[model samples]
Target: MTRDHSKTFYFGSRFFPLPQRQAVWAVYAACRVGDDIVDEPGGGPVVLSDWWARVQSALTGRVAFSQAGPHPVDLALGWAAGQFPIPVSAFQELYLGLRMDLEGQVYRDMDDLELYCRRVAGVVGFMIAPICGYSGGDRTLEYALRLGQAMQLTNILRDVGEDLARGRLYLPESLLNEYGVTPAMLEAAEVTPEYCALMRHLTALARTWYAEGRAGIPQLQGSGRLAVTAAARAYEGILDALERNGYDNFRRRASVSGTRKLLMLPQAWWEMKLG
Candidate 1:
């Protein structure tokens, strides 16, 4: 089941030095493939079914999973898992999360959203944390989980209009009900004061989660703390951009440009070391 890492993922792995970089690239490549299966268009039920079955079999040691799917990412992940101490449970959780996406399940509330985030994003953190030499302490896992939640929350906020267009709503119904903003209204791209207020409220919550996530960086091993800091700060910057725009995700997608991300690296370094 061994395979070369995904090209883009390999390049991205250059941030780390030596063997750690190789290990991370393999994991990223696998995740990238799993992501493609769920995110890419034109994947039919049969294709997804086969992919899911292979993922399970590969993880369970029932079959050899090399680069045989629509993409080589999963094969790469299998190889990487075999070569390292990556958490298989986390990878399984990630696959299950993608399966949910394939089924087009929508979030009903924060609890549902948390479940989805835990499977899809939280598990990725868990998988990476162990690779980064973070022990499975409550504080470390808690921060990783919150970081994942924050990332998911930011994604949800950024993609609200797009998700609504595709008949998905991530904003908790209870909050929407409390605000008296209906799904139809959100679908119509209504940027009313109520909607704006709701978005701001949501962003505030995401910021809190990001703060909690950052608290556990000091506990990371090797250069992982720096890498995670860069990634987290870059993501947080996206949320900041959303906030600066008065919580307007409808007019344009919020992003932190490469140049800004470059600037963030130094800041992340400072936060990881001096701060």
Candidate 2:
């Protein structure tokens, strides 16, 4: 399958200042590529396993199989790490989370859910926090972790139907049982009121977490703050879209259009610039 780089316009979006844009793109591209290896049609566990191995090699500056030629994601990640004081362990965390996707792991409870979120989203926050100059106490970092968890939870909630179709379930099992929702019900694309109520509750929880995430933005440094803010807002916007659609994600995939996104870019810029 052909890898499409066309959707990467955000990498060059004017919302990001020049200095950090390229480095951010490198990290985003790396993550997107790794994710696509699992997401592509006909891509299987063997393919994902191979990609992870490549990612590990690239992270250590030994890119033997990356299509990025001499400039592998790991090398780019290393450069980004140098430019920012991002923790190396964050990359490990992301890798661990991505592995879950390969195995179609399910969450037994909130604790399991938290671990998955840490792997996928928390590490992203860890990588980004230092770049935004948010270095302080463990409390500040704790906020970042919660911020990441909020985003990941939103994603899991929004993609519930899709993930189920893919033979994966991210909702906590306890919550499912509490609502009388079964994996089979989810797999069958049944949208009962209970399911809707559960999704509404989860989405509300995510919104609150994202609101908490917003508190850390002001603590960030200059342009980096704007970049992170835009990302956070843009992702939250997806949740809003889901709400507007009446949470019928099973029938329609929720998305913010390019025009809306374009408007958001300027609005976000003004918010950060004037403030």
Candidate 3:
């Protein structure tokens, strides 16, 4: 699933030992299922709500589907939760984030946007921290949150045009107003100086978070540190690709090439070893 949906992440996961790699795959698959439902045209509030309920049932061992004996993704995730210290609260918060998407909620400011990012992405970091061998540290969790936000911000920037087509804008309204970039401008796929400036500002913010997140990399144990560092570098590479293209996200999608991803591995290994 990771290979199909996220090659960068799939590449990074290879650094982990078998158990951790499988656990990450399980978690990723479970998250992907929810994401797919929300992204589907026919998926509505009822569908999202039902999906959340089924996830809740699966997490609690209630078994939502008897004949099928539980969803395969959920079964793997349930095992992962038992083996690791997966927090149910994080999953609940993720569901709430999905709810926000279903309601077509718009962010009024950075605070609102950050809240959405935290619920949708930060919680995943928290959930994965224990699996990565980091436990019971507020500092580690804070780093996880920062990294998740950084990655999500990158996603928001990269998908700006795509999201606008869906009648959704992850960028904050206040920022748009401040930059004198209107919704119509974005809707029309305008790439004016003001829009470019706005994107630069957002990209800088993401870079800051990425740096802060990297500062906590040494805190992770075993091969998880290498996996995370690789993932971070690969994701950050997208930001670099965007900048290199003059932030023309509408005309083309920003992506890190496979060769570039391969280049990151050795550096990631060195960083892990040095730390």
Candidate 4:
């Protein structure tokens, strides 16, 4: 599933030992399933509600489907939750975040956008921290949250055009107003100076979070540290790609190449060894 949906993450996961890699795959797959439910054509409130119900059941150890038994995602996640200290409430927050998408939610400012990121992506970091062997406290969790936010911000910037085509805008309204950018401008796929400036601002914000996220890597133990670090570098590389394209995210999706991803592994290993 990771290979099909997210090659960058799949590549990063290879740094982990077998058991940790499998656990990350399960967690990632479960989240991917939830995301697909909203992104899929013909999906709506009924479908999302049903998915939430199934997720709740799965988290409680109940079978989500009678005929099919538990969903494979649910089964994998269920096993992962048992092995790690993943909280049920974190998944609940994730569902709420997905529900926001279904409701056509818009952000008023960075705070509102950050809240959404935290629910949808930050909680994912929290869920995986235990498996990575980080058992510190709020400080450690803060790193995970920052990493998740950085990645989500990168995703938002990369998918601006695609999201606008779907009639959804992840960009905050205030930022748009400040930059004199309008919904019509984005919807029309305009790549004006204003749009570039707006994207540049967002890209800068993402880099800050990425730095903070990377700072927390030293806190992690075992080979998982290398995996997480490599994952961070890979995701951050998307920002570099965006800059290289002159912030023309509407017309060009930014991504790190496979060769670059492979190169990050040795650097990640060096960082892990040093720490």
Candidate 5:
């Protein structure tokens, strides 16, 4: 699922030991399906409720390795929970984020958007960190959450044009107004000076999150440190790609090429081990 759904994630997860990698894949599958519920066309409350029930059952130790029922994602999730101290609250928080989507709630400002990002993406870090092993306790966890938020923000920036076309806008209205970028300008896909400035502001904030996130990597144990380091560098490369395109997110999606990702691995390893 990771390979098929997300190449960037696959690239990072490949570095993990087989067991941890499989478990991470399970968590990713669970989260990915829930997100699909919100993003897929014709998804409604009924389908979401069924999905949520399976998650609860899986996390509570219900196992179904057969082809009978409970879904493949739930089975993998059940397996992962048995192997690790996987947090139930993380998925509960993710469910809340999906509910917000179902309700069509508007993000009032950066704080609101950050909360949304935490629910959907930050909790993912929470799920993955314990499996990776960390020594600094909550401080490290907080850094992981911030890292996830940075990636989420990166996704937001990359998907702005796509989201707007779907009649959805994740850009906080406050920032838009502050930058003198009107909704009309966004709707028209205009890459005006004001729009570029707004993008630059967000890019800077994402970079700060990335810096803080990297600080926690040295605190992680084993291959997990390198896994996260490579992932962070690869994801951060999207911000660079976006800048290279002159912040014209409307015309194209930002991505780091495979060659750049391969080049990042050794550097990520050296930085994590020595720096």
Candidate 6:
């Protein structure tokens, strides 16, 4: 699932030992299932509740996943939960974020959007941190949370044009007003100077989170540290690609080629060693 849906994670998890790698895949697949529920056509509270029930059944072992219940994603999650101290609260928060998307909530400001990012993505860090066995505890988890937010922000920036086409906007209204960019401009796919400035502002914020997240890398155990470093490097490469594309996200999608990802591995490995 990771390889199919998320090339960056698939590339980075190559460094993990078998157990951690599989656990990571399990978590990702489960998250994907939730996202699919919100993203797929005709999904709503009814089906969303059903999905949540299955997840709860899996995580708490309230029902036998194999005997008459649970999706494959939940089954995988059940196994991962048994093996590690997976944070149930993280999943709970994630479901709320899915609910937000289902309700078509709009972003009012950075705080609102950051809260969405934390619930939807940052909690993913909380879920994975225990599997990797961090040394600094909450401190490491905090950084992990920041990394997830940074990645989500990158997703927002990269998908601006696509989201606009879908009649959805992730950019905060406050920021748009401050930058003097109108909804008409965005709808017209105009990369005006103000829009470019707005993109630059958010890009810098994501980069700041990336830097902070990287500082916590050495706190992770075993190959997970290198794995995370590689993931961070590969993911941040997208930002560089966006800059190179002149932030013309409305017309040009920013992506790091597979070769570029491979090239990043050596430097990532070196950084892991240096740490």
Q: Worst ten-residue run, lDDT, model 3?
A: 57-66
Q: lDDT tens string, model 6, 39-157?
A: 77877899888887777777786534545655677778888888888888899999999898888889999999999889888898898888888998789899999999888888889
Clashes of 4: 0
- Total backbone collisions for each predicted model: 0, 0, 0, 0, 0, 0
Residue-level lDDT for 228 in candidate 5: 90
Q: Per-residue alpha-carbon lDDT of model 2 for 1-275, expressed as tens digits? A: 01244221362233456556656666666676667767778676676666566556655556554454654565776666667765657767776787888777878898899899878877777766675676456766777888888878877877877876777788899988988887677777887888888888888888888878767666667677677667667777778899888888887777766666656777667766654
By TM-score, the better pick of 2 and 4 is 4
Worst 10 residues of 1 by lDDT: 1-10
The candidate, 2 or 3, that scores higher on TM-score is: 3
Model 4 residue 250 lDDT score: 83
- Measured by TM-score, how close is model 6 to the native structure? 0.95
lDDT of 4 at 273: 79
Tell me the tens digit of each residue's lDDT in model 4 across 199-246.
Answer: 899999999998888777887778888889888889989999999998
lDDT (Cα, 0-100) at 137 in candidate 5 = 95
Q: What is the lDDT of residue 167 in candidate 2?
A: 77
- TM-score result, candidate 5: 0.96
lDDT head-to-head 3 vs 6, winner: 6
Clashing pairs in 1: none
Candidate 5 residue pairs in backbone clash: none
What lDDT score belongs to each candidate, Candidate 1 first? Answer: 0.71, 0.71, 0.86, 0.85, 0.89, 0.88
Residues 1-275 of candidate 1 have per-residue lDDT tens digits of 11242222232344566667666766665666666666667665676667666665555545543565334545555655666567667877887787877787766677988888788777767767776777548789888888877877878888876776656666877789877888667767778889888887888888998898888878888788877787787777888788777776776778777677787777777888863
